[model samples]
Target: MNERPRGIESVLVVGTGLIGTSVALALREHGVTVKLTDQSPGAVRVACELGAGDEWEPGGDRVDLAVIAVPPQFVADWLLDLQKTEAARFYTDVASVKALPIEQARRLGCDLSAYVAGHPLAGRERSGPGAARADVFLGRPWAYCPGRETSPRAVAAVLSLIELCGGNAVKVDPVAHDEAVALISHAPHVAASAVAARLVGASDTALGLAGPGVRDVTRVAGGDPDLWTVILSGNARPVAEVLEAVATDLAAAAAALRAVSVDDDGAIARVTELLRRGNAGRSRIPGKHGGPARAYAVVQVLVGDRPGELARLFQVAQDAGVNIEDVRLEHAPGLPLGAAELSVQPESAEVLAEALRSHGWHVP
Candidate 1:
């Protein structure tokens, strides 16, 4: 097949951690040749074993694209080092924070025409190659920032790379990218960590009462602290600004709750307004396929924590010609039972519920 202008046929993936290995795996899925390298030999070996790609060696032919999947602080320097060796015809990075890295690249006199900074807004709370999945970036927004010096060739190459990984390319300014992610990703992680930290010395009773709400709120707190530290430090100002707003709201809520001890009607109004604002903010989040926010009907089923139980639930839904749009599980701690909250179209909810009930399954 004839390729487009310097289309990405082969790629060199640096840093075989979660993002790098995931990108390599995704490219391999699309029949793109991938070469892997990392600071840790063991890490790269694991990635290769996981079918991400083959190991890289010096003096090999320069690839069409190089993905520098290191941290934000190290991305620019790594780009400079790789460019000195002509690692690829075009280059990009998977560092979440963009402005600082682009600035560093300029300060180092790197060839900006060959580089585009990118970040895929997708990841698990876990880290390392073991946590990498080829589908991690599927349907996710891949943000790209090409500076004034960036060549059209570089932008085209990275766009192909994002498409190969099942991502939608979104062009953004470097500083704006940092600010946006600060509001959405970085600051939320810090807030999650703060809430999770409060659970450190809780009593067993309090812990037992913990449910999916707490888990969902604190889920991202499980991310690698050292890595998050680098990302937050790179976009300190924007993240700090977001955190300040969050703190103000939280402090207000606390004060309003304390005032309710005196049977204050104004305090109740204040708390209610905060909750209403939260509902508004949540509703603004994009739903499936980047469409308008939708409200799906939920069908809850008691699930057995054993093999094939969840599959059986899906089978029932399928037999009823119902599609499951989303799912959330609430496990009964120390028990072998849980609730599988299936989200489907409002029209499909009763059909699925009836199917499950007829199949000797408890649908609640």
Candidate 2:
């Protein structure tokens, strides 16, 4: 097996929750030794049992990098204590926001020179080690904030770690990082929650009639409330600013909708234009960071739930030189067949569909 670079032999990951465990797993995949720890001893044990890192060891050993993946509120204090030990030569954090931690670190007299702040713009609704995936960060954009006191070596080490996890790193100032995340991540969470909150008391009949659009809009609302509360609190100012803008736009939309009357064709057109602008604005968001926006020619196909059906479909696609960008499986009761939503490049969709159909699979 390949080994980590000789100079950086050991990595200590503080907080073995979903993000931390996933970082350990990804680092280990590249043959790096990792030590995992969390406030709760049981949580640390769970991470080790899940093979996220090596068994915990007491005392400070010479280590190259320490990745702090705890909640934003706890990062500064943890980094303060970790910096006192020889356990780490340099430190980096995966907190969602940056400015607050930098300020807190300064207050704690932590050595910002050996610390770099990083945020990976990738996550899932699930929490803890069980939900961690080695490839969770693959192809995702990781933002790095190098404070004024940050050292060259510290920046380089964190950049290397980002690349090692199969991510692209972009440098941004701490304030900029907070503002950007407020617009893209934090505001969206609040919006999703707001939408989902509206449905809390809806009748079963109303919910049963909901479609994919509603499902997609409210998906992030199912995320861990405890985790989100910490994140939202840490970046409350920027988040509130963004939400205020959203409120203004929502008010205008409501006004336009309320203006619908027999003599209000102009108001109706205004509402339509507002909706169009929303669509256009959303389309501007990058689909996947590394690659171009995937132009998916979605193909629905019928396959059995039994083993090998998926393998056969994948094999057929591979043989046809069709790279499947994404896949979704749906099943209905009383039917032996399930529908697979295959997202392939538009150019290969027709040929791939034909190939699967020729293999005795039902293609739509």
Candidate 1 achieves a global lDDT of 0.86
Local accuracy of candidate 1 as per-residue lDDT tens digits, 127-164: 99987877567546899999889999999999999877
Q: What lDDT tens digits, residue by residue, belong to model 2 across residues 61-172? A: 7678999999998899989888776568899999999999989999999999999999987787778987776656654679999987889999989988886775668899
Off by over 4 Å in 2: 1-7, 261-263, 288-364
Which pairs in model 1 have colliding backbones?
A: none
Of candidate 2, the 10-residue stretch with the lowest lDDT total is 286-295
Query: What's the residue-level lDDT of 313 in candidate 1?
Result: 66
